[model samples]
Target: MMTKKHLALSALLVAVLATTAVQFFPKTIQPAGITPPATAYRHSEETSSVEKPCSNEHPEWREAQMIEGVDIAPAPACEPDNPYEVATSVKGTNNVSMMTLMQTDLAQDALVMGEDVDKDGDPDEIHIKLEVVELNGSSPDGEFLINTYPIAPGIQPGLWVYAPKSRGMALKNFNSMVAIPMLRAPSPTIRVEQGDKVFITLENTHYLPHTIHLHGVDHAFHNSKGEDNDGTEEHAVFPGKSHTYEIQPRHAGTMLYHCHVQTAQHFMMGLHGIFVVEENHPNNWVQTFNVGAGQVRHPSVGVKNTYSQEYDLIYQSIDKKLSQIIQNATDPRLVAQRMSRDYNMTESFENYFLLNGHSFPYTLRDGIIAVNDNENIKLRIANVQRSAVAIHFHGHKATITAYDGVDQPEASRITRDVFDIAPAQRIDLQLSTQNNGVNSYGPGLWMFHDHVATGTTSDGMEPGGNMAILAYKPLLDENGMPTMHDDLLNEVFSKDYYAKKQALWAQGDFKHLLGDAGLIVPPYWQIILFGLAAGLLIGLALVFTLKRKQA
Candidate 1:
């Protein structure tokens, strides 16, 4: 026998009780076809923080090291110093430390040597296994949501590159225990001797489908089994699948290999690399794959006879808007849709330029061509960027020997300071470190960079892009660091410089005239005008309010 008012109050109380119950035990509404992020990948908090011992003797017993706050045993003096530690040595910079990828032997990790048929010494049957890897992409469970591989200081653009199929954690030279997939780009250079029976396998480890088109490499349109040997989109290898491409290259020169599926987007995202066919020679054990393109530590027979050192220079540019789409979500479908359908390359513009997968300062770490006073250096240059690059040498001119895998005639070889290479074109240059003025201007620390202006900048910041030094042995320290003058390194290498926190001419000769004038104040005349405008607006508002009250 409750009144209507009492019944309504009782109902209200019941609703409040139900709401409190729901607060204690809430149900989640999961979207259809979309998996929860936590189930997708393990988050960074789940990772262990134990300090592990590093041994040069047992290099195989190594683990992947987290680049953050990494404190472990020092690398062996015998091996190359950890480029990661070397890069972050500059004070007042929080640049992500480079992965100890160089520690993992490039020759062994990338090249699978097969049986020597003729038995001159080196293996005749070459097998190269490559896997497609996504870099700087987000994961539901990762510490930063994305595993960021910064190409330049404070700039982490998402990229996908071809990496050699490596197993387990990197054992040596790493500071902490991290996975062993040496994910990097301007993907590994495939170096094989002419007439060698090569089997190039594409292991599609990523979520999307991909193919490797051997551009300019001599191969049949179809394989023996009549499969698409041309590596076109017609025969793409999907995720969790693999395909082996067989070929015996007839020519010997620099060529190219890249994904043919969605070529415009895929190529820009960094699936292409230099494919080199060395001159046919007995016992020519070439460093089959130059992962993270730089110096070829083990020179081929023909190269050894011609040049003192060999380098693979691949230049590329990133359109930030397109490359950054992958970082916006953790789902593969969403990213793929955005890149393939939503992105318009014609409307976008390239921002970050790279030389062998790194911008400047970072380039100084491994991109240096350490030369003696009178030495001949062979440089295999490729321009895979959207725009053409006018590569200029600061202190010397180089002689062009080849173009697009074809050797230029001795009479046709041209020597110049700047060489203009178009998109997808390869040019071979013979750099002479002779102090004879024409070829060499007596190199102290000669810088070689793209003269396209934008090519020398990382996101519009000068001294931040594809710039490297041709350091003479004398100028390089025992650790291979160039003995540069002044506090130039201190200023340029800091994060604040790139972040626009510090003024460009704060330390320059024109500091007094052009230095930072913080918190700029408006002129007295402008301030007076603003005050009069404010008074007028206030007077009008008061008049309107009084009229409304009278009404």
Candidate 2:
């Protein structure tokens, strides 16, 4: 009996699904770190597989084990390698498996802001040295200085992973700071406790060129004769180098480490990170290596305390007009103007979209966006950016159980909000407002953009670039940190508390409290003008209830 065109098509499909479940009701990757180790190192039979997201591939590497699908039912005369078993129709093209990761550079916040080396109580294995001088950062002054040392002196552009529950420590001499890493995105984090034993080390000291590809580690490559065993074009570490790469990640999840070179302008000139391997075990301690900041779910409550709760987002993006139109071409003519004058392979967005770098007073250094109950708890997300990232969490719904680092499928537990991710993609979202998620519309002060809509908005301004939120009353303080604390951390430690919030927000009288003004009115056309005024007030309440039932 509801026929005002089905009550204006059910109130315009519940107001366009309550504005896409009211902003995709929140949101949320693949690829575990990588895997491989050493005895004297450098030993590869080579491998590479694809059709094996969870099964069948070549030289074996979807993380050398733990695949749960593909009707696997063959090889088993008591073999001994069971990453979780599942390999039946073993196909051809030698599935995927490649490894050779070595990049280390930590100095901005130093892995979760914790680094207690030699003081006799954990946190110091981050020994750094990097060097790329001259661009204003300085250090050249003598015709390319040929030998200031560290031409990649074993490049470990910062990686101090630790996950103990089954063993996976990848520390290579943990240490940090020397200048010239530049990070900014959502970089700086290193929590662990899920099958630890992930040691890593690549002390290059920098000069230029770098290398660390564990993009989605699996180890083994080009074997059976040919060459190249995932050492990224055969291990690059120029400008004053060193090398130490190992992986024991028997697959536990959420991973990435950038710089595969020219790799989209070296991961957009800030390398990348967020290679967490934490799952907590039956009692384990000893984690200390800082640079981008994050680590210490436990280290004696982190020396005294620093992170009882946290969040790092870092989903980067900034075409700054394509890095100023590829800084006037010239990398072989910008690869021949990207293969003959930019042949639009999807133009790729830009004009700025950063979060941990600056975009809303540098997101106020991570704070301001609240609702109480601690902004609903746990959310790590990281895209690093190139393209593809659709988060949108207004009324909340994020339950993602991990991806790109694996873990999810305990019967798909949790309704999981929405997510799109692509480049580097790393998700850990557990976000909630609780019971059907709601702090009075996910309560207090929420938001967590991108779900497209021009990445929430930036170069076009309405909500200018890579937005932020979900902060609610005390996003973390008492030393646990973060509560709108950006300006690239006092502009990389020049400090002045962001020069007094830009001299009182440039005198704009608090301009909407600069929290990114989240609510949805950002170039999204106000949720299509509130779903066309909720479809003309449900078609005028079904034509006045059909003229009072035809009087």
Candidate 3:
């Protein structure tokens, strides 16, 4: 029933699709089995407790958690919006306030550390001022005044922690560049009590578009009346606008938030943060975490260590070539266009990755963990990406205790050199640097990285992004701990140099910054050759059919 023209068109499409299919076929890997000894693992015990320490009492177990590889560098304290801690005369003990944050190219994806106007141990109020300032020899000519307002308290403390949706960008000050939490988010934490109500208002101060979408925690989109509920399209905060999202996460677990509006770009630009809700009913304080790991030795009435230590290792891959597509957008008109455009999926990619916002060698938290003697730990890992990630370390096998924030004793625990991490997948793995069965391995420095070789690279450099180590060092007296923090190490371990370099590589140098668009596509010239041959054969067959028909 096919017409001659239709058949010919179909043949061409088939050839093109055939070539694509063969060229980009999916690759699969069978991960090695991680079956721990049946007797060694106590599935029946309500608590999985360990009896020995990392050093086995040999005297080296001085520190419970030691960071290897990266030198320790504590980021300097961010400047308060107001140098003089002025407290606003806000009434209620747990008062409520609201503010709108406008989106600007400068404020595009910066971390906001607004002034905590109320001085209630929380950034009671946040100010998001996004506007264009005239340059006077390189800096804003005048006092660039932006709106500052009080927003409602985030997730109540002692309950859950919710990651904010954006970052605050800083301006260059003379020869030095200062970091100002422009988005003005309070801090890296949120507070809550059990059964407490929560309200958050987001004012769109930015010119472009924006919205906040709670990742999990079963929030209602709209109330019975259908107003802008917790999770609804109507809740979107457009440019020069504002909106408040309210929710009560009765359930306890880690949650996330991102700009639902234009998620592809906004989320890629660091619009996501972790929301952890703690279980705090009557007669209960939040259980103490194992410090380094989110492990809880003494579970608070309704709490469990889960996997032990829970760290929200948010993985993001950036294509510097594309970052410039947004970062370098000088003109406001063009910047808005790029942000709103949905046709650039082809240019999207993962050239750089991040763990807690920094790479390895920069991850060592003072290069040590301080525990009483011995302890158990857990790592809450999440692969927040569309691509697959392979996580591997030089030492230790992780027993996965949970996935997607749910405890899973029934799920098989696999220990391997590499584990594939899928997009939006969270894996809770119980880890300990101390090797019980293996005696030869020393309790020292060991490296951990992504098994997928490509995930390790920054926008350009190899073996980059989210690389860190779990250092096991002996707990020493007070003298052993290096002055809590030092300034010299800060400069030495700085990743700013490499981070920018990788971005440059992704841009493909000045010569071909946007270079050939086909670069994103993997080359498979062999597939093209096969496709050509197939096309030739089809042509010959068609010619023969035509001759027969004519006869």
Per-candidate local distance difference test: 0.69, 0.40, 0.40
All candidates: TM-score: 0.74, 0.27, 0.53
Q: What is candidate 3's lDDT per residue for 40-138, written digit by digit as tens?
A: 211121122211111122122222321221111111111111110011111111121221123111222222233444343333222222221111111
- What is the number of residue pairs that collide in model 2? 119
- Which scores greater on TM-score, model 2 or model 3? 3
lDDT tens digits, residues 1-551, model 1? 34476456555655554454445432332211112232243324224221111113334222223333432222212122333322222100222322443344332334556677888876777777788877766666453424345565445577889877755443322432222334566688878889888888898988989999999999888776778888999899999999989899898999999999999999999999999999988767665656677776556779889887788999999987787676667678897899898999889788888988877666766577778788998999999999999999988989999999999999999999999999999999999978888999896888889989899988777887898888877786544557763345545554445555555655545468775642122234544455555555555555576577778
Task: Please identify which of the two predictions, 1 or 2, would achieve the higher lDDT against the true structure.
Answer: 1
> Which stretches of candidate 1 lie above 4 Å from their native place?
1-110, 142-145, 169-181, 505-551
Full-model lDDT, candidate 3: 0.40
Q: Could you tell me how far off, in angstroms, the CA of residue 407 lies in candidate 3 after the best superposition?
A: 1.9
